[model samples]
Target: MKTARAAWRRLEPVHGMIYFVPEARRRYADLGLRGRAGYFASRSAAFGRASAELVISTFYNFNPDFVRQAVDGAWDAASPHQVLDARYAAVGEALRRAGIHELPNLNEVLALTRRAAEAACEHPQGRPLFAAHAALPWPDDPVLQLWHAQTLLREFRGDGHVACLLSEGVGGLEALVLHAATGEVPVGLLKSSRAWPEEEWADTEERLRERGLLDGDSLSSDGVLLRQHIEDRTDLLTLPAYGVLGDADCERLAELASPFGRAVVEAGLLKLG
Candidate 1:
């Protein structure tokens, strides 16, 4: 088990994700009855909607009640699921029209999620686990949810600048952070957990430094300037679902939130109330 975990850790990306299949299969094959019992007990429902709801519920569990209320308010303002369905349908249809083979069905989505979760259990990382539950028909990959949650948490804590450099997207926690902290896009720091030659690390460091984001093992002056921008851009008072003011505030927030809320829901980051 130790050998397998070490290998998996070495293979996993430092700032990205990994799904270690072979290691997972090996671990599952070695589990005793007690381990099996716990595994099945936790994952038996990783085939549907109930599981998805449970995952979302867990995310809301961490916040103050008012935060949850605010999230609910925001959710109510948007036509939840409609935009998601449209997006999914569009993607599916485009794939079909393009004659793409091996497109995932509901069963495949569930199975893939289960496989990933099983891998996670075998080589557990500190990250949260999500899987497709019985009630949801969509791709309820827990890893994706974990990423979303991590992104949100980082954003809430004013650490979203890193996220912006990690992916190409709109207003991701990282993007928001970078936007607020620096008035420009941040360059990525290419440091993988897997060992690479020192030359590669040196090259990466040089590139990042040249971009004015890093300065010899630290953020450069430009990076500092960016952080200032992030501080000014974000509003801490806007809760997840609820608005800052009373009725009037809620109304105004709802109007402003409708589009973004729909986008988030469509991305499957949040659920409809």
Candidate 2:
């Protein structure tokens, strides 16, 4: 089986940058959005008729008020499909301009991705994040299909992660704290991106430390094991999709996707390093 981290890394570079890259942000701005709030407001509007709270809670997994601030202004500006299509076009254009799409075997990678998605079983109930996305109409072009598939795969694992976290009694802030403690994400970035206040975050850190999950500023041995368990469970949960690809195909997909992923990183799209 592919390691959980490896699977995430291979796909992260492809779709991870949509929210952070200058290209997508500029696209949202061109569509009359203000900043990060506007981008989340516009892009997430694709889930038609869903409340901002639902998007915030289920999809973005960020602070409720932070998401609400964005949706308040974004709802009336454009329909969900319009914002989604525009964002896709703009981001895809950026990739093309950067020659990411020009990579050899581009079609092969997309084809393998789509095949895996098609073979995957339908999203189960209770996974609102995955179910919401799985319900969307498929795009016609291979590029869009690749993006959509990646998006679905992400939500698939995301919903599973949420469930796992909940079962472990880890709420949003604690989840972010744990991730930061493990060095999965930088603490400053997590705090800023999640709109978490300093005092509240410090409190959460204290609680984690008290729980034996943290030792001072870093994760303890138990903390690392817990995180690894969650990740392993997440990988197992996502196996339904990738299992369809089989080990050989999964490895092949990674190999084919690596170059394009590297280009995105080189363009400073994904904030991985």
Candidate 3:
């Protein structure tokens, strides 16, 4: 299970970096998408004319009105096919800019990652985002293919995560509050990015406190337990995808993927702070 998490973490930047990469936004802008609309459009375009309501559900944690503003008529700017094209083009440009293509073991890493990613596509029962993406034709370029694989795996895990959170009674806002409390990401960044109002954020915190899941700005003991349980269940759900690769191969994948992931971060393509 730890191998599953570690492997995914090592490969995450390959896909995630594209969001912050300038090339991606530039292509989106070419298609008339501006501001956060590019983000909402580029990510959800895989859903072919997806309604804002659908994005609100799948994107979970973002303010619904904010989502509506971002995704409303997004397809009018560019068809889903065009949006997906621009997305992969960004992956290529950004990775090339980062000199990721120069790595000695790029092919080896992508091959292993793709195997697990394809295996994940086998069970898309409740993973809507993953299912939508898995249906797309595979990119001929190995670089784009690698990025596509990580995208599928992450979304697969994400869909399962939403299920776990809902089962644990953590609504999107509540989940964001708890995540903020963990100190992994600043509350200001989350609140600003998600467009959650200060009043709502505070109210969510207060409600969490009332439920004994929060103490001040952090998680209470019960909250800690619940968070752990959610993550554990999420890991368990994502495990079967990696299971096809077995523990040893997954470890090798992590080892091979780690340097590239770190290289992406070091290249300043993905500024987390």
Q: What is the C-alpha RMSD of each candidate to the true structure, in Å?
A: 21.9, 2.2, 1.1
TM-score of 2: 0.91
Error of 1 at 110 (Å): 25
Compute each candidate's TM-score over C-alphas: 0.25, 0.91, 0.98
What is the TM-score of candidate 3? Answer: 0.98
Question: Best TM-score goes to which candidate?
Answer: 3
- Regarding lDDT, does 1 or 3 come out ahead? 3
For model 1, what is the alpha-carbon lDDT of residue 57?
Answer: 39
Off by over 4 Å in 2: 3-8, 271-273
Clashing pairs in 2: none
What lDDT score goes with residue 258 in model 2?
79
Residues 1-273 of candidate 2: C-alpha lDDT, one tens digit per residue: 464336446866677667766666666676777666556765466577456787777754577777778777675665677677677876677566557657798788787777766555364566776776677788776666777777777777788889898888888888898889877667888888788778988999999999999999899988998888887887888877788777777888887787877887787776522
Ranking by lDDT: 3, 2, 1
| Positional deviation of residue 54's Cα in model 3 after best superposition, in angstroms | 0.4
Whole-model lDDT values for every prediction: 0.31, 0.73, 0.89
